[model samples]
Target: MGEPNEVAFRLTRRHSSVPRARAMLHAALGDWSVGQDALDESELVLSELVTNALRVRVPGDRQVGVRILLLPDERLVRLEVSDAGAGKPQIQHPCEDETGGRGLMLVEALAHRWGVEERVGGIGKTVWAELKAQFVVPAPAPPVEVPAAMVRPGQCVRVWGCWRTALGVRGDLDADGALHVVIELDEGPPLRVRSREPLTVREAGTPAAHEAAEPTPG
Candidate 1:
């Protein structure tokens, strides 16, 4: 939640780049620990945006620009597609039998907010959409040091502000005799942390220590 993560890719104006754009967005969202709902919606939005960009008639050398921004604190994901075309995209209401013209309608339905902005010092504009990110609750941390002997698989532990399940203990040990622990998180790839690292663990059917609040006056 400190600083937002941003990634940008220059894409050729071709239909083939649409899937590639979606794939890059998927990988970026996975790294950001975005919820599946947001991820799916973002991919759909990216597809529409990139398709529009590819359809636009830009200068021969002008490449489409795709950028994704993740704002953890605000829980917002923003996507932008840029092209050098002179015309701005507009939503069209097509008849039922029409097979096209529903791109912007779908974007309007799924995104929290969307709009187009003129590119700075450029001949074209950038169409953007933002989706609210849904994040998973992290596991609670242990109040005191958890003995390595007591750690085991299927246990939830807090690491880097996210709750993750312990997969297993790696055979290798650190210089301090702490074991390298493998963990499965709600998002992204598996992680490895030292056993001695301070972590919050989840006990079955019990509330985390931090959830205990002072009792109200009777």
Candidate 2:
């Protein structure tokens, strides 16, 4: 059986933090099998939530934070942002050129459901959103057979990709963003990488793209 379907990521304000969040999500959830529409929606939500935290943070204390949770069995994913500022965020339908508004409204229009609440007994507040989907798991692939010589270095085949968790890609990203990739390709400890943002794989390389796998799982 697979491990628990719940995972959490906590972070402070940093330039690379947002992309790390996205990459971590993609890794933990097994390639984000999300379709074109869903993928676009998820990315937009992440952007809005993170950007809000950045813009409205308390300057003196500088303790702004973000958390992402995925509840796969329940068919929902949640994004939450918490900051020292106690001001309640409103989802205003602002005019086209309102100096600084429209974040919450965009979230409301996109999320299946979203709301704001006090952070338990805390001083800050958490603006959050939840999205649900009729997500389906892919059928397991049949085995492959090939010559040992064809496999090369640094290759990530599906069988291998499934079990590995990566924090980030080494060369793909610039200084602004990083990734926190987690995979379950095997029963190994989840890898927590801090990587530069690389171009996301529209499709992971082909079977022949990288090194071939050993006959058995790593």
Candidate 3:
């Protein structure tokens, strides 16, 4: 959407920090408009990193640090988890009989690329991963204008502050013979507008509106 942004937080070194880390990562990536699949993968990667960070032999008072960055232009998302532990994390290949030591394996499979680096203060290490981001672009604005009377089913109209498909339209004359137009939308309730009121509408098959055209009223 706009420029890239970063979010950082610290979590207590405990088993509870795993889900909390995932929640914060989800919130940050969701705000960046990341796709569902990417969000899922990113959360899994973060969970593994945080879990490994928690297992590090650090002091009780030392906390785990997490950082998330989204680069819209590059279509990339980066995750980092740091701990004040002594040793570096290495990917392990455990036998089938072993039920553990698979965290890094999952990270390697899910992330685009991953590695470790020494913490800035040199007291600990930071595990980082980068994942491809799926960003959905908004549809373009409507170009063609259609009059309310000419509006037909399967067309798109901007009413109630949203773009909705036109389900049906009809005009009725009141006791005074003043014409009132009723337009039905695919979502929400119908709309009733006076014949003279302005309406925002677009023909079918436009970029902003991709509804299949229906037969016009006889």
Candidate 4:
């Protein structure tokens, strides 16, 4: 169960659960801003899975469980339906005149991968399908920080009466265009401090001296 990104619920064995499951999928993927074509495909796969689960010969008292999970890395959407049925599902090729038995076929055609797995610690099975999807909103990139050359990574700087080795540098420009360098220090635990004032810095084994502030480009 992925917090804030997954939806899981149990539904009674009824036809109405199918639409409710589709609505849940739409709400989840819609918040992620997935592409329409991908959303449509996900909805179709979900519908088939839920419908098939409802048809299984589970005890009348047992309910079907539905889970929708979205993976941002591969832009993948997954659907799972669980029921206490006694058999695995197999895809079938029906004659053109047959009006039914094409649910698994449609799922195999639309989903990148589909399979059945034993329900964990339960007397049932879970059928899952994964589809490659496209996100309308792209994932955010990591922040890139500009480096300040005056204080190199290998230099040592005095902070609070102790000399800490500078591990890295990051720069930021103020609203008034003033330059500030954020120095990452290797104390007991890693620490960071902004250099907005004059400070003493030097090589690892050398005497400390004041170095003129250098500007970091935006």
Candidate 5:
């Protein structure tokens, strides 16, 4: 039963998109033959994980994401909360009066099983949880087809073949030479990135490529 029966998303859990997540979940899992209670539980799990990721940011930084993966057979759904940090979540049972300290506990009670695993790029981790549902969710909507060589705006993108180098040059400069690395991804959303670290601008396509390095401050 180790088939690739899974759908996962990799979005940053930033402050934005919090309100829309619920509806998105419904859109993703609405067709499945699952109970409303199960859907509620899954949404709760996603919120818990996504909130934890959001808390990682300080006064600065934007929102990240929590991806809901509908397992094959539509029998189970996987919730993965990813972040840009090195840490694992622990489940704690708090007292009745405790206002907090009971998120993971809720997940523990709701999910069939949950655990954490390292992410692919060797940066963060994915807090995974599974809920029973039996989603014979009809054949997944036919994938929106597009020519291989074309990657428009608003699409989930990943860069494949690429190379990067670190060159050091000092002296502060204005936005004169600064360049905005914007890629038009046709499908998901436009990536609006403003950062201080090395940026990675990528688009959808075979052998996808991304430019490394973030925009520096003036």
Candidate 6:
């Protein structure tokens, strides 16, 4: 199970602080092993929030607070930005000629959800957004089972890219150890193959020609 991870910092309200906050957020997401798609969206959301904070009516010495949280098990990531200014942000319908009213609009389209709330014990507010992370699951391995009776002389078995007649059962072991069988292929010298169920001989006169013909289980 994965646990929650978080990163937080303060930035002085300045135009240069936008890139600095974005870099820190990028580093934190990388350390938390976030996916590329989520990381890109996160960095964009961070930039918008920071820019809004810096553009608000805050004093020269006021600082912006940035925070990021990752919930791996939940496949969720949250970003928050707090400012000393009391102004609230809202989505605007900017005309085609407009160049600067689309920040919150971009945030709404990129994030799964976003909103603003009053800052605790302060005069300002915090803007937050949540994004869904893309987590990949690995495929399961195939199953192979061989019966003990199948390991014996005169048995036709397919192994090592060729069919071979089992000379004899050198020895067999439990599940933890491999079963040793001496097989003589039609072309090459006699070779010994170890496996739990490499032998393809299910019945006499019926040859299991291909070793890799079996379908892997899901």
Sorted by lDDT (best first), the order is 3, 4, 1, 6, 5, 2
Superposed on all Cα atoms, the candidates' RMSDs to the truth, in angstroms, are 11.6, 16.3, 8.3, 11.5, 20.3, 11.7
Rate residue 38 of model 6 by lDDT.
90
Off by over 4 Å in 6: 1-3, 136-218
Which candidate's TM-score is highest?
Answer: 3
**RMSD from true fold, candidate 3:** 8.3
Which parts of model 2 are misplaced by more than 4 Å? 1-4, 31-36, 98-100, 134-136, 143-218
lDDT of 5: 0.57
Give the deviation of candidate 1 from the true structure as CA RMSD: 11.6
lDDT of 3 by residue, 1-218 (tens): 76879999999988999999999988898888899999999999999999998888878999999999997777999999999987778899999999999999999999999999999966898999999999765565554445567777887777755578889999978889889778888888787767656566666556744433432321
Better of 1 and 2 by lDDT: 1
- Give the per-residue lDDT digits (tens) of candidate 1, residues 1-218: 57989999999877789999988998999888888999999999999999888888767678999999998887899999999988778999999999999999999999999999999998789999999999766665533336443556777655555455666645456788867665555555666655555455665334554533222111
Using lDDT as the measure, the top candidate is 3
Better of 1 and 5 by TM-score: 1
- In candidate 2, position 83 carries an lDDT of 70
Q: Name the candidate, 2 or 6, with the larger TM-score value.
A: 6
Candidate 4's displacement at residue 46, Å, is 0.6
Q: What ranges in model 1 sit over 4 Å off? A: 137-218
Candidate with the larger lDDT of 1 and 3: 3
- Among all windows of ten consecutive residues in candidate 1, which has the lowest summed lDDT? 209-218
Candidate 1: residue 10 lDDT (0-100) = 98
CA shift of 39, model 1, Å: 0.3
**Position 63, candidate 3: lDDT:** 95
lDDT of 4: 0.79
Stretches of model 5 off by over 4 angstroms after superposition: 1-16, 58-63, 134-218
The reply for model 3, stretches above 4 Å from the true place, is: 1-3, 138-198, 201-218
